[model samples]
Target: MRVALWLAAEVGEGGRFVKQQLREAMPGVEQIDRRMRDLRPAGWAIMTYRDRAGLAPGELLLEKIGLPVWEKEHRSAGLRVITASTRRKVFERDGNRCIRCGILAGEIYPDETEVSARLTVGHVEAHKYGAPSGEENLVTECSRCNETAKHLAAPRFDERQVWDEITELPRKDKQAVLAWMAAGKREPSRVERVMSHVWQLPGVQREEIFRKLGRSLS
Candidate 1:
């Protein structure tokens, strides 16, 4: 509600704002960023530096405001009516990483280091009719990818290019890739599991663990 009021009154469409500004407006409200993201599916166009140039890190560009969620009529525009337990289970099963891009929560994307990825639950086959909101049907996805996928606006992948790369792999590797495709989810290796857990740890703990591992390797 505060987010809606602030955007509608203070920062109108095409206005530039930052995380700090939002935090200031809604003092003591943690997860204001998440509140902002909740408005996305309702037609809000809040672009970050990663999505739009000229915006600095922590800055947000409000390209367009979709639904007036603050209004009584349109209050539930982008809200997903899922249970809290379901949300937790889905996140845990996916190891709190985006299955689409393999991006872990709060980790910066390789190409867009300025923007950190936030994990969200998304349907594996979004367009499928009567898709159940179960562990089998849901997967972890970053907010960016989830929104793009929901809108069917993801960039086109060249099948031939992808196929060529796949075909060039060794026979065992090709089979492994095929198995993952068939299952529709890639099982993480032991090292990947460790890395995912470490990525979620505090900075100090992560660094200490890395040093310990380095010593063990030596």
Candidate 2:
């Protein structure tokens, strides 16, 4: 029982079940085959190494997925087509850093295969906007970050509607509303408020924004 619980903690969920088991039973633990079966619900997955003894030095295992990635498709080619390019030129141009996040591929990832063309090339502008094909519009993104941006990028909402909704709220709420409307809330509250005030005061609502994003900010 102790061995099973320890195995679960080390290679399985390692959650409340394992903690409870340890508290209830302690001292000498032996092997770990008995507790493997019937431990998890159908999709409550756990990952493990093939064998610890065979592992190369400094090669460790990932024992849990934590969140399973349901890959709908390898999106790079589709995105390239959408952008009217056989290859995303901007990814080649930027040297594999997400244009928005400034994360370079070699900086964080371990896979040499992922360092170049396999790195996700994200669109700085909307794909619907002529599906920008030029290198000026593409940004290198990791698949994870690209997934997040794609999930967040939906149909546009009216900024006027946002102002009307939050005009009466506290300054903080007003900031939240503006931040929600911006391109991923990259700026601080104070910066947004000042920008809004500047735009509103001058009656030049978003010309500056267009100018700002017109070229590579990188």
Candidate 3:
């Protein structure tokens, strides 16, 4: 609410601001950027340099004001509290991997090997415009993708390059890719599904299962 008020009264529509100003205004408020981001769901049009050209890094533009959440009647506007059960269901449905990037929980990122991926639930659609918190609307996402998606930023990969790579795939792989695109989420292969399940077992049980599988293969 304070962030909304500050943006509206201080920054005004189409005004440019920076992180330092926000910190100065809110002084010691934890996750001020996150607080500002929460307003996006309520119709606020805050734009970063990625969304708007000519702005330097760390600068932001308040393009429009959103819901008056401070008012009693609109306090809960554009926000939905997801239940714990729904989170569990979404994680299970996504095979405990990031549906967008296919990174498993605690796995190191392919690009940034030093950093491990952490899973979180995010809307399959843009949650900023009031996407529901139901299992159907949710999917497991890595922390990196979740932040990027919420900001409505351009994807890290080039579209033409991605398409070119996709076109070069073998016929069976192409078909699998097509299936994943049609479903809006990748279906883990049988082996991957089994591995996901195995990851959930106790350490000793997992070792026993792996040993039995090795014996069978032998």
Candidate 4:
């Protein structure tokens, strides 16, 4: 709310601002950039260098202001509260792995070894205004993906290139891919499901199972 107020009162629509200004304005507030980005879902149109070629590396353009989140009636605007049950169901449905990146909860990111992935529920159509919290509309996502996905623009892939790659796959693989596409989600194979469950076990138990599986294979 403070972020919204600061943006409105200090930097009105069509105004340019920088992170330093926001940090100085909201002293001791953590993740000010993230808080500002949160406004995007509420119809805010903030453009960065990536979005606006004119913007400098450190600058932001407040193209438009969104809901009056500071106001009492609009305080919760653009935010969806997922129920505990819904979260559980969504996690289960996604095999407790991030649907976008396939990183399991507590697993170390392949690129960021120091960071362990944390799972969160996120909307499939996050950019859509008023996207629902229904199970069909939700997917399990890693925290990193959840935070960065909205900021990243869609990848530019040629339709023919994608189709050619798909066509290059074996017939069985092509069928599986088609099935996944039709379902709107890729179903985890039985081994992937079992591995996801195993990843949830205590470290010692997981190691023990790993060793047992290795011995059985031998």
**Which candidate has the highest TM-score of all?**
3
Per-residue accuracy of model 2 over 126-171 as CA lDDT, tens digit each = 4332355556666666544554465432333477875676787999
Candidate 1, residues 59-136: lDDT per residue as tens digits? 888877787878777776656334567778888888877877667889988866567887777777672433465667
lDDT of 4 by residue, 24-111 (tens): 9889999886687567557676766644557888899887788887877766654545667988999988888888767888898886
Which of the two candidates, 2 or 3, achieves a greater TM-score against the reference?
Answer: 3
Better of 2 and 4 by lDDT: 4
Query: Against the true structure, what is every candidate's RMSD?
Result: 5.9, 18.1, 5.6, 6.1
Looking at model 4, which ten-residue stretch has the lowest summed lDDT? 147-156
Would you list the rank order by lDDT, best first? 4, 3, 1, 2
Q: How do the predictions measure up, each by TM-score? A: 0.60, 0.27, 0.63, 0.59
Task: Give the Cα error of residue 56 in candidate 2, in Å.
Answer: 19
lDDT of 3 by residue, 1-218 (tens): 78888888899988999989988998878888668766655766676665455888789998767788777666676345566687788887777899877889889888774567878778777764456667887889886777677664457778898999999999998998888888866677898878778988999999999999999999
lDDT of all predictions, in order shown? 0.76, 0.43, 0.77, 0.78
True-structure Cα RMSD, model 1:
5.9
Decide which is better by TM-score, 1 or 4. Answer: 1
Model 3 lDDT on a 0 to 1 scale: 0.77
- Residue 192, model 2: lDDT of 48
